[model samples]
Target chain A: MKADPKGVLTGEHYLDGDFACAEGALAAGCRFFAGYPITPSTEVAERFSERIPEVGGIFIQMEDEMASMNAILGASWGGVKTMTSTSGPGFSLMMENIGLGAMMEVPCVVVNVQRGGPSTGLPTMVGQADMMQARWGSHGDYEIIALSPNSPQECFYVAIEAFNLAEKYRVPVFIMMDECVGHMTEKVIIPPAEEIELYPRRLTNSPPAEYLPYMPEDDLVPSMIIAGQGYKIHTTGLTHDERGYPVMTAEAQEKLVHRLINKIRLNADHIIHIEEEDTEGAEVVVVSYGISSRVALAAIDEARAAGIRVGRLRLITVWPFPEKRIRELAPKVKAFVVPEINYGQMVLEVERCAAGQAKTILVSHGGGDVHNPQDILEAIKESIK
Target chain B: MEQSRTEIKITGFGGQGVILAAYIIGKAAALFDKKEATLTQSFGPEARGGACSAQMVISNSKVLYPYVKRPQILVCLSQEAYNKFEPELISGGLLIIEKDLVKPKPAENGIQLLAIPATRIAEELGRRMVLNIVTVGFFTAVADVVGEEAVRGAIKDSVPKGTEDLNLKAFERGFQYGKNLREHGE
Candidate 1:
């Protein structure tokens, strides 16, 4: 479906990644935003507050991130596209409710403009340390989708993509942005409304009488219905039956949890998006995401000048891990060099997927800033040896 | 400007529009001049009275490394900023400063230095906040990374709605000063 013309601001803009992401959310038909202001991520909320009035939406400054997460979930259930943005500390606060949103099959967007972590480490610095946390922070066996954008232009598109995925999958999707990308300013071109595609909420056509909220359709994703539509519904985080009633039996837990996980796992191929360059028969491949991917390109150029057959595999969709591509490339490439702002988070997944068929090297940093291109180049050079 | 990439840095105490100046230059290059530019900034916790710096990289191709390694052009509006960032300028780089705010020692390694009284010019225009626009104009004429018309377009796009004329006048003053220095070796 085409985006709503009323919400779209189509033009060329010189904006930072945070502002661009907010614009993308608005363009994606996000009409409700509830978030507390935090550095780096605050711009997203600020932009929404400034523009939502003219866009005819609701912008609420919640007391805290916990309230922000819950409000978006409630707003999503009330049948509007919703989102919230935050950094490390706030992201941690949202995790428990994020798990609730997942269990309730709430479709919403959560953006984490990550900063150096382990507890408010660097408020104004860049970090990718939250990649693993983004995957598992909410707990349980349920699956969620995550995307990493490297530029302000990509941040705009990624926010829209995140909303679409959240609606389609009936899950809370994450936009895993870091401080570098969040604060970096660049040119972003927003296309016309008709050119932008949006995924409308998958509200059930089944009348209130026949609605069984937790029942999965052919795609393993159950259709959602707005609250107060009056067909007698129950939403809870506990294990439940298809009728949306809490059930204590082990069988109910198995059936509910399996479908929740399989909805994403079975559809992983469709949900995963990656960008590859020069990987065909290459000996060494650089696996990176978010801001690190752009930095790695510079090292790749230097390594190429020295005649190293280095390729690039950039994860546009960071979650679902693009496992098949990694497994396929692992056997062919001599080694995979993973450079991220965190100290060896995603490299573990690469190593597991490689399964000893090839070597996996981690060019790790503790964060506060991006890795120097020379350090990545040194890693690329060492991969051949 | 023949090089594929040109790195530029602007630094001052906060409330001096340091970041906005960088944003305008980057906007000129990326949005109007048909070049690629990336801008990043750093500042302390204090919102209005702390040291602030913004870095930009303009290139014909995509900028892979978002931060500047060694800036080829450095504009310092305060003495502290100059003292802090001067050593990071490349050997043959061009350094621009505010004559009233900064005191420089001696130039080394063939570095070209230009000074403009941007705050004074902005004050004369009845708005001291346009000082950044003045520096941007000076940069446009002396640095040669972005075209004058492009910077003009960016300024019109960026500044507040009613202040365009005053900012443009400030820009003209700085640009004229810079052109004179470059032409007759003032």
Candidate 2:
């Protein structure tokens, strides 16, 4: 219930950027957090270190992000909610394991509070350049559920959703939050501990001898059996048969790959999230997410006051790229503007969705500064005309 | 078109509470008064002694974007901030400076100026910690961004356990200090 939230608001209690992320994870029922602290993202590890104990959970500061991700995979298999957070450079290092999680059908959340980068570009400055990489960073053909939260409150709920989607589909999820949002302070009211609807991992109850880790049945997500729970489970990155034995045959590979992709793809409607604003008859629609979307929404209201028919399509879940929704909204909206911290990263997806039905323009910025609303309002003015 | 939004920027050297000032003032306007406010900070490498700025947008409706290109209200806590931000304010906007740290500049045509003893007033309060809240008090006094009650609410909401007494006293003194500044010639 909506308690007074008297002493429970941890971010309100005083935390640096990294600790805010950790508290969000803990509040999201994250039973396991594993990672090595670098410079800026270290507080996340420290906070998780302190928090995991209180909830009867475990926190492990692994040797690296790869091990961190693998440990989370292991823990999630042990039937616990799992997550690991890293910065841009660490995120790059964890790419292979992210692929592993994708192939192994393991549900775990990974957060990248991004700093500047081609490689360790700026460990402290904020950057949204990782927008594209969050979707295609790991090698493979699989859909992802990447959420970008503009503030700490959204960060809390999005972490839960990241974990929820991960378990529901058995895949790795990304929290594509910038460092600014990670560190910023605000009056975020944490709902009472009882109000949280936390989704723990789904465990298999099949007999020990007959357990097949990859056996496809009713739900495309094959039930996962804990490693040491008296279950003979064989899991691998290579294509496996129903008995969980690695098979080099193309037929076995197709069935496995298709199941993995469709498990998420078939549920695209349920996974996609878009926050709409006064879009009924909008002529100019700005598609922005993360902290940048905060400005986009303000710009829309400002333009509307000036008699501009503006609206906003704020992506809460960016990866499954609200394609059908965008197409439906595109026919009615005359123009689409994407204002991101990076230059035209997400607009590419919006353009693909628009497909000439609507004019797509990029209101982009870079090097840590979010795009200003006036630039977007100017774009709206030009687009509507 | 009726303007319903106001974008302000607070820029200063490290440890000046630029970020905290933005939060208190923005929260004062948005959350407490039921308007919309968005707060953002510049990414700092030094984390100490480097130039830092906080951008805040205070509006009557929903705040979509938060970053500022041209500030309508620019408060400079150091000369570096003054030099960096003076050119960025829209012509005829308001500029406030710390008298001890920055030399006062008169408005050309559209811009207005204020010279405040914010650092001295905060120091006189027996806590140099209140400097950011002092600046926030000055912002409310000049721009009517939000009421004093809202600032207090923001303060209470932003401060953590055990530090409430210090922050609350700091905020009240800062509010009075700004009032005293406005009442006097400076």
Candidate number of the best lDDT? 1
How does the DockQ of candidate 1 come out?
Answer: 0.62
lDDT of 2 by residue, A310-354 (tens): 878889899888888889888998899888877678899999989
Tell me each candidate's TM-score. Answer: 0.98, 0.84
Q: Which pairs, if any, clash in model 2?
A: A294-B64, A294-B65, A295-B64, A295-B65, A296-B64, A297-B64, A298-B63, A298-B64, B92-B110, B92-B111
Candidate 1 wrongly placed segments (more than 4 Å): B1-3, B44-48
Cα error, residue A29 of model 1, in Å, equals 0.5
Please report how far candidate 1 places residue A145 from its true position, in Å: 0.5
All models: lDDT?
Answer: 0.93, 0.77
Scoring only the A-chain of each prediction against the true A-chain gives TM-scores of 0.99, 0.93
